[model samples]
Target: MTPSNPDPDPYLTPGYRPGGATLPRETPPGETPPAEGGTSFTGPDDSHNPTDGWAAAPLTAVLVVAALVVAFFVAYAVWFVID
Candidate 1:
């Protein structure tokens, strides 16, 4: 007989937890981290992104902004003293 209150999902009941969501198996000895995004549910974390370590930070751009901020403060102080 079917359950009187049938759930929407046939494969997953209210309390079901899939094996893939369980903690990962330990690496035996000489193996690398488990495969990502193939048979496994998780892809590499952002640290493992394809673009990881691809570009240096744009220090010149940041320095330009920092210079502008310093100049603005200096000008404001000078004007305040002269006024």
Candidate 2:
């Protein structure tokens, strides 16, 4: 009789398995993957859009007040130097 086979990788021999490993089932052509398996978005699509007016009003008011304070100081210094 001939010698028996020692290596049994499925890739090497079509009908053989090295240690009885199971292969994943094949998907049919043109079929979409199941909902739980498909790719998904991780965050909101409109995350860059501006917020509502109520949330932005306070920041606008603060910037306007800061600009007025700076303009007042600059005007006072110029007048004092010129007088």
Best by lDDT: 2
Off by over 4 Å in 1: 1-41, 44-57
Candidates in order, TM-scores: namely: 0.37, 0.34
lDDT of 2 at 73: 99
Question: What are the RMSDs of all candidates, in order?
Answer: 12.8, 12.5
Candidate 1, residues 1-83: lDDT per residue as tens digits? 86577546634433334553323344233334445657555656566547544244576778789999999999999999999
Off by over 4 Å in 2: 1-54
Q: lDDT by residue for model 2 over 1-83, one digit each (tens)?
A: 99987867446533334566444433333343445744577557875867566666788899999999999999999999999
The candidate maximizing TM-score is: 1
